[model samples]
Target chain A: MTALEYIRCIGESWPTTKERAYFEALALKEHGRLSPEHVPEVYHFDRTMSLIAMRYLEPPHIILRKGLIAGIEYPLLAQDMAEYMAKTLFFTSLLFRSTTEHKRDVAEFCGNVALIKHTGQVVFSDPYRVSQYNHWTSPYLDQDAEAVRKDNLLKLEVAELKSKFYERAQALIHADLHTGSVMVTPESTQVIDPEFAFYGPMGFDVGAFLGNLILAFFAQDGHADQVNDRKTYKEWILKTIEETWNLFHSKFIALWDEHRNGSGEAYLPEIYNNADVQLLLQKKYMTDLFHDALGFGAAKMIRRIVGVAHVEDLESITDVSKRATCERRALDLAKMLLKERRKFQGIAEIVAVIRQF
Target chain B: MTALEYIRCIGESWPTTKERAYFEALALKEHGRLSPEHVPEVYHFDRTMSLIAMRYLEPPHIILRKGLIAGIEYPLLAQDMAEYMAKTLFFTSLLFRSTTEHKRDVAEFCGNVALIKHTGQVVFSDPYRVSQYNHWTSPYLDQDAEAVRKDNLLKLEVAELKSKFYERAQALIHADLHTGSVMVTPESTQVIDPEFAFYGPMGFDVGAFLGNLILAFFAQDGHADQVNDRKTYKEWILKTIEETWNLFHSKFIALWDEHRNGSGEAYLPEIYNNADVQLLLQKKYMTDLFHDALGFGAAKMIRRIVGVAHVEDLESITDVSKRATCERRALDLAKMLLKERRKFQGIAEIVAVIRQF
Candidate 1:
């Protein structure tokens, strides 16, 4: 047993982990069923043992965040990710599935409550409150952390987001779909570690990716040295953020158009058959999703700065004062984005806002 | 057997009926756990037989709608109903319950999916689409019904609301809290027929009550005669509507304030401990809730007019043309409310709007 594979053993001690592995296996099975090209094959699953064995994407396939830190850009990353998101999200949602199927899947994923609770605490609650688990760069960023806790507007926005997180089961979300959750190479991008997967707002996954990329862009200043100014890498990160949302919008709409006659209970083909109404429906849907993505992304950013889990993008930056400055800038941007997300019209406006900070 | 008590019996052919009985029992139990006064006592529940035997509010406890139609004013109607709404909604919500308890109840009520589906259709879908189930006062208001179906803005607003109805499980709601569901007299108000209870937006319950009151107001003219004129009764209905919301607002806040230090996971006492932030949080929460209630109430009104079900208020108006006029005014008001609900500031503003229509 030289750790050739990860085995989530069934035991009295790790009931939460055991359940997560089971849910992850179930979610992956569902993902494969919906879109196999985007998912890893489950080699074996033992319900009694609470274990799953899956494929290994060997070397060159590194965590996307590490690749970003190394100033390596995946050419196909945006395109591949958008396809996976549109497919997995559309296929699993009430926009594509029957209510019967949707409710059954929702009920099953409700058992993934532990992972959801973890997210609820880390993303929504802990950051806004004085929590023992919460940490940031000490003294240098102490005031910034306190400001976050004291920002009534920010907490108000977060409270709405938190309620959405706990209550809204819009679709099956890869609840931890940050950059670190992705394994990438120059030509391939694979989503991994969906152990935190559950039925949640699709924007949560979208925000995690985009928000982490923004964090990556900010951290580039710290990662820069004499050898590389990292200016080009920073631009590349920004371009990826813009392109991901743009590509996702186009791809999601294409899927919706393709499935207009499908069994999506949200909009019946008979009712939404008119072109004008269809366009209006899609525009409203995408706009809401965009705002949700921005709001959730900002919350993710804020939490990484002030909540329990710190992201490697900023954490990898060594200088205490320098890292604090970077984190503070990101924090300010996140707070603004979270509060004013509804005012945003498109990714272009968002990119412009990102450039401002 | 002669009906001494309300015994919903089990039957092979009516499995849904059996399930509904069980759910009703569960909801009543939960409601009683929170507040015993407003809800009927569940004496016996036989899961195997799919039956529930509950307390009967005998004699003067006629349906509230009947009281309104007969021009009978319950002096304590506002106080009793508001208390019920505040207590039942607050206690069962994430505001009071832990996430574990909340999610568990939410899941249990999700088993009441059949009723949820009915609401999704009748309240959200049928009014916007040309469904065969849709009906109206025929010839006179055929155009009004057609306008409801054709109004793009109305449908767009409705779509968002529908999604919320399906996705947002903010609290354990009395899904059908219309006047027909209440048994009342001068001294008592008891909510009954919670067979459609489920975890949904609290506004659905609040909206149902207020919207029905609006319908009753509009129908007063049809019920008027030389003997009584019914103008005073209409004024009374308006007063009750106004007071119900005002009182409900105060009572709900009082509950929130009282439990500000409790286990409500929404706003942790540590973070929202500041009086300013707490006030801000409550204001935001209550404002959002008001908009939701208005939107949902408007939807309820619209469905009753042009969707599958017609309320006794409008249906009892013998003159077809007279009835159409009332229905059309209601339809217009509902459309405006659904589209411009966010513009409303408070119960006073809503009352003003109702007077204009």
Candidate 2:
């Protein structure tokens, strides 16, 4: 006999709750065509009750963050994650879809504004202002939090990022792409809980994944004890961040080249046909994307340290002083990344900088 | 007794025809709050018939292009036009409205995509590619038109402009703001026929007005007679172009300052309160806007010369060779503006460049 589970929301956030259910169904249906291996199959959905019944990621499968906290290394984690992000993001982007298809889907997803508004408040707005929702490792990092609230240059960069998040619908994005949303085993990696999906800047997705990995890396020091120094695992995390971005960039460009003459409207082959101009267009596009990813990734990191939500990676550490030290290092790197993201040209440079901190 | 005018459409472009009816009503209703003197009051609208009945700008009122062709100058032209552009654009921008109001209007305008598509084709696509709709002066502009079609650098720039036209929803714009769209007299400047109105980049509206003014300046030599060499009229036109942009910039900043503490969502007062950061934000914003206006204006000029639509300022000239010479000068200047708009820092520089040509 087989067992089935149906999930339902119990509170006032039902509109977004229902929307997430709808989007997950839509995404799973579409992503099924690209690569079905990483998405949970939808069995049934009830829109009125905000209920969903689907495949359960049982037993061996565990949240990636939990696995990371336990110092367990999934060797295939980087490759599987890179493939999932590339296939899901690229397939849903204008780089692959027609304008008609793209706009129609964009309009549909704009109804997910309830969730977007929540993200806008927590990730961009609340951290910079005195808000009831905001918290941190109090007393120990009190001055650091106040400094974040008063940093004019950092706020200026964040304003630009917030505008992009609100206005620039460059692609359909899984707005919350953190490690907590992934379930992993030694042989497989599956992305789950994408209720925050909508048409937004693709950099938001890339940044979330990389930013969460940084959080995990910083938390390693807090997790270290006499038995395992955790130095090697930290190196592995750095390598994973470097490899994921490089692989995703190459894969995205490969898709662009493969579909150069396809239905994508942004760069028409007839106009951008010559080798020289095509190369120029690609370089400019990727450079801008890289900067956006860094800026947004830094924003995500800052919000985790001082904003409404605290990550489990840092919260799991028992000692307050040790946690605060790890968090301050992350905060310092994040500030540098947000203000000086444009100066960075590549992911390897970012990895090198991460090691410096 | 008062008379009434009713317009009815008979064909497939009825959606745009109807949208014009809808927007004129919305604009007039809102514009009434700002300045009822410039925009005509809508009397009646019938959606099924795709019709509008509105106030008529009575005699002595003539299309501004005709007045320019006759070498007649209105002293209040610069002030009146600048006021019109500032009031309409600033009031409709996110600088003045709340996000809820802005998004509602933006979504409503997105339904007017048919007209937007027409603009995308005529203004951006046709000139860059060989299309049946494209027409220019035979023999005189045959080579010039061919050069435009083959100019890779020009097309590349056009592609960027096209993307902005299709993507950036910075403000509500009169997408066809040109001299021909204005009714003028010695005392009054009235804007009419905003049938292509939609939520788009504000620079498009600013550029259209200035680009048409530039076209009128180039056509002065063709209108030159033994009785009137038009040397003084050319200087007046140049002064008007320079004054209009400078005045518009000042007035826009004034509005931003006035409403800095208002519901505007782009730069919140809480974050952008300091003088140094405020100055930086304003300078960066206006500079980008200036470049966008110049680029869009140049694209408008190039289209009028080489694309499906030809401006009356150049077309009214009887001699083909004379018309061709005037057009080639305007085209040369426009191509420069489109390619090097960012290099220009102020309005005086643009006026100086115009004088050089």
Candidate 3:
């Protein structure tokens, strides 16, 4: 008989204080109850201690990033991720709750300001400006990082995203949803490490996951050898990116359609009544979300290569010259995506661009 | 010795509870300290008793709306109001403070949800749909009320504004900043009755003031009789509207410029260093704010006409037919403003439109 195993996860944050961790445990336990299918169950939480007792995934379950690095393919990854993102984001948004409930939750999560500030600093602000924390592949990518600082248009887009992240209480997001934050087997996917969870733009969450995957795909070139060319794996990565966005779009719309008559004050049934109106709103909303995701995803990618926190997928490549080449390709694409995201329409076009690179 | 008079104001809202009043008092005490020049000075606050004891304006400081109805003018009205709006809104926004400070204050003010709900329903919701509370000049405005319910394009725009009202935590706004909210004289202007205060879109506050002025302008026709035709007074009102917006725009930009190197995080100085970029951002910000004010102003106008609360300017007119004629013109202009506000670039165009109406 399968039994439960408990794991103690204590909060140790940047300032070496329990505050951020307390919020992390609180966020996981708080939002985990809302959607339990993909998130790990929180067994116990001690606020003062900044400790959390959660489920222990067995050895067979590896971090999604590591699996990607090993050229492993999880066929159901896109479907599972789409469902996870859609449910977690949709249920927490104004589409599902009244203003009273939404505001209450927003205020409660705003207490997680420590992590939110950290994110606003690292992912949004520090990447563009010269900071002691910022790093890159020296000599090879120095000019590239300098270029990022000087690109006024890219900086302008980033400022918009930064404000959106701070202002839009669109949803309670699992604020850090990179591949390293996910654990999976062939049949199972579990989301974890929501230390940065707060009411932020939903696109930030979607972008984080997709941007990390893009990082992993670029690193595949460095990992390839005579035995494993990793050509099929790279193709799989592109297909997964396309499928994830498309599925999320459809699933998010389906939830909205289902809850059209509920207490959600965003779109009253008396107002958005006709099929044509619904179609119009849906298209407009998805288009905005699509662009938001692309812009944010590109920003996240740029930060990984040039900002403080380097992804293991790139770091583990070992060969500095080859790794820089792969990184430069990702960097150039991210810059394009960040600056010209509005011009992009569908994920297929994005996939086409990836193939070109 | 000059002595100050005091007034005890208790909150008595729709549901007949002390909670809304407590928040009102707290909001006054909390945000009132920021700009006491315009807002009435709060002397005491008893939260449990749901009471606020504030400075009492002596005689000659009549309600601004009553002054407007009597064809009285305050030459300094636009200047004082512009400074008031710019100071209170700017100091409390992310443009003047860090996210940490802003979020903390946002969460604190979210406690005033009772009035926020009342506003969301009456100002934004109930006006769009049928409700027993909604009333108009029966038989005269019956068609106009019904037309509001059937106007799909108008309703679409309302949905957008309503969502913005809910989602955007732009600044601390005097949630009900109508003409009645102010007590004015030839020399001194004292703003009072902030019982419906909370953190909301700045446009809501600015729009409330301007929209009520527009109502007064329309009602000039009905209030006209044998002596004092109110024609010249109406022109002064139009000029006041133009001056108010233009002054507020300049003063707001001045504040942003003054604090560009300060703690405010909206437009970080490092990224937005260049003159060209600053111009681009200012134009974009002011444009969006102008449109938001226009849209919200139009909605406020619509609700006053067809919704539960009828303004004294229109209601005091004895002839129902003549009053309805004025109301119809205001309603038509408001509908156009709501739908076509984006096309407007400056306050001069708006003043021109008001003249045509």
**Per-residue lDDT of candidate 2, residues A227-335 (tens digit):** 9999999988998899888888887888889988898767777667678878777787788888988989899999999999999999999999999999999999999
Error of 3 at A6 (Å): 2.2
The lowest-lDDT stretch of 10 consecutive residues in candidate 1 chain B is B1-10
What clash count does candidate 1 reach?
0
Record all residue pairs in model 3 with backbone atoms less than 3 Å apart, i.e. clashing.
Answer: none
Q: DockQ of all candidates, in order?
A: 0.61, 0.42, 0.59
* Backbone clashes counted, model 3: 0
> Which pairs clash in model 2?
none
* iRMS per model in Å: 1.2, 2.2, 1.5
Residue B118, candidate 2: how far off, in angstroms?
2.0
The numbered model that scores best in DockQ is 1
lDDT (Cα atoms) of all candidates against the true structure: 0.86, 0.82, 0.86
Model 3 alpha-carbon drift over 4 Å, by segment: A1-3, A11-13, B1-3, B11-16
Give per-model TM-scores: 0.96, 0.92, 0.95
Better of 2 and 3 by TM-score: 3
> How far out, in Å, is residue B189 in model 2?
2.5
| Model 3 per-residue lDDT tens digits across residues B6-116 | 757553655735766676676666556776767777777776676677777777889999999999989999999998899889998888989899889888877777678
